[model samples]
Target: MTDFDTGIGDLAERLVTATRTGDHDYVADVLAKLAADDPRTRASALLRDLVDTGAGMIRARTREDNDALYTFDVTTEHDEPVHVDIVPPAPRAALRALAASLNRDAVDRDIHAVLATRGTPDEVVTVLVQCLLWTLELRDTRTPAVRLNCF
Candidate 1:
């Protein structure tokens, strides 16, 4: 796999380990890494959109259902009140669904779903989403006590 492809796997593994150890900082660290101006921004933006429209599609287990609302402060010095929302799925759902997409009967269908929502026909993104889903799945393990509905 390419570095970018491999990076997703690495990120997944890190998220897994982080969850196992109850390290809340790992998500922040992953999100904060400035890989590309657009990619990172898009990642955060997609996260916001997910929480807002597709909440429970990739969310933290620690948060309550009402806490699914996420506000991304994208305000810049040149901008004002630039805010965004992120509705994430429970980590478990994201994991199962994402993994399922890889080998499940709904491969093309799942991919189309993402494309409709994420506007990407790129396989790279498909793989990346899998990684992201796996990462969050591991993250959910950190808080086994906080259970919620899984997709």
Candidate 2:
């Protein structure tokens, strides 16, 4: 994995642990780090609201045929549930090659095309973080499927 992937994975793990333990300060810290960019800023805002409202149960599942597509479910204190499906960009190697070979506009267009089937920025990011966490958990446990009951 690239440094970017490693960083995101670490952040995903930390966010999961913090949320599970009800560590609001740590969650805020993670959200602050994630809010550095535009889309992530919006995503972090949504996560902050959800965490504050005690909606920390994040579950992720990958399709049997396609590991690239992930489904996430989160339920709030009031029992309001939010679901999102996210298909992350191309593989890191492919994306890196595209970035190196193409212009900024072309790279943007390609990425946009890959992400066109998503939901809001917040939902996408939220689901992505959960998905990353699930992958890491799967790796550690060697399980066929993992359910993150880390509320």
Candidate 3:
């Protein structure tokens, strides 16, 4: 894996641990770090996109029951949002889906080709729509109280 992949994987692992223990503090710390570094300006941009797209502050849980799985609770700044299951780690199926998703004829193949080669977590998110897509799907399936929806 590339450095970006490694970093994201590590962060994902931390997220998982935090969830298993129900440690919101750890989740906040991770978010804060991402917010502080603002690597590739992804953290804030992602947050903005989430809010604009109707997603709210997300609380993620990396469950002990499954290694390749994660769950998120999307709550607003004041209201409780919803829970969304996610697999932050790149799995074969997700990759295949990602390859297909990025295969749109209207899209700039050159950009995604470069992004795939570069292999940064931020780039992966951009290319695969991983986090955002996963959040939306999981929320709908898992929670009924949530009113937010995005594609």
Candidate 4:
């Protein structure tokens, strides 16, 4: 049997309430609650989305020889395979597009789309963490590690 068959329904409902509040801490807290009540898978997925969606700060920003660069990575307890290309400081329009894409894609698919998209490493990491928290609260999953790579 799956945790989804047990108290997941009530937990999911509460998660909706938390999200509607638009309070990051609330969302994260409720997510943690859900994890405690449910399975570890939910926690994993939640953490992945949080890190991928910037639902929390997951990206890294630094100046290298006066040149700014971004680094990002994705990991899954499900062990989902990813080969992501490094994205630099893209144009404002590009970043906006990425954000729009992430929001739309994350609505149902969670942070999968955001994890797949290329953006500033810092932004990517942050989104993943935020979305992961939301995902766990709204659903249930495992928490994966943050993988970083530079090119």
Candidate 5:
């Protein structure tokens, strides 16, 4: 695999472990590294900007067919409002699989409501990693929309 791919895989693993174990510092460190390594992508840039701001909000909405839409809103240093939406492929299925792999409880609850209610750090990071992985997959596919920053 390419170095970028390897880096992402490693970071994803680390983020999962950290999130599961409630290691917020480790999660933050991993996110910083990811942002530094891939500053151009929306996910990475958003990570960097959010870290810089030290405050942001995430909203989740469930779509049809077990899909999900995650919206991240943050204000930049210039007071510019930025909103990013990350819709992972079959998010409910993906999150269920993730929970299984992590040996966590079944995701029977409404994930959107959980997130909107300021869910646990674990929930937040889990969704963030999913979105990051989706973005990386999109990058690998060289999708025209991703290439054109149309996502």
Candidate 6:
């Protein structure tokens, strides 16, 4: 089942509660809660983590110089084989888009149009990730790693 089953409102309530704790492990605990028995939920959480990490880098103005990129296998909507090789300094928009896709209200009308056009929520997320992946796939250099699985 997707987070639609779990309810985004409940997730937001938990997140608000977690942030109030001001503890470092709050994110991990919340992620564990979201990851319960659902691979897509875990994948969504992982993508959110990547976006958060990239936002941190943007805030710190840090640029990594390395050749190691993180890779993950993603089964396409059509059951085709694919992989994502992520590098450091992930795009802020990509991360925000992933997060917004979950909440349903934060993303623009275009994303909503996907669902209105008969696309499932899961498929919308997969398409978002794949679009971001395609941009990264064209990148020849690499630094750092971020992995998330969606199948």
TM-score of each: 0.32, 0.30, 0.29, 0.25, 0.27, 0.27
How accurate locally is residue 139 in candidate 1, as Cα lDDT from 0 to 100? 41
**Error in Å for residue 16 of model 3:** 3.5
Off by over 4 Å in 5: 1-6, 41-151
TM-score of 2: 0.30
How many backbone clashes does every candidate have?
13, 0, 4, 37, 0, 0
Q: Write down the RMSD of candidate 1 (Cα, Å).
A: 12.4
Worst 10 residues of 3 by lDDT: 54-63
- The alpha-carbon deviation from the true structure for residue 139 of candidate 5, after best TM-score superposition, in angstroms, is 24
Alpha-carbon lDDT, every model: 0.38, 0.38, 0.38, 0.39, 0.37, 0.38
Q: List the residue pairs that clash in candidate 6.
A: none
| Model 3, span 27-133: residue lDDT tens | 65555445445233444333323322222222222222322322234454566553433323222223323333323221332233333323444434442344444
Cand. 5 TM to true fold: 0.27
Better of 1 and 6 by TM-score: 1
Q: List the residue pairs that clash in candidate 2.
A: none
Worst 10 residues of 6 by lDDT: 84-93
lDDT (Cα, tens digit) per residue for candidate 2, span 18-133: 66667867665545444444444344333322322221221222233422323334444565673322223322212222232222234543343234213454435444344334
Q: What ranges in model 6 sit over 4 Å off? A: 1-6, 23-26, 33-38, 42-151
Model 1: runs farther than 4 Å from truth? Answer: 1-6, 32-96, 99-151
Tens digits of per-residue lDDT, candidate 6, 32-148, equal: 443343334443443443333333333233344344222233445675664433321122234334434333333442332223222344443444344324323323224334333
- How far does residue 81 in candidate 3 sit from its true spot (Å)? 16
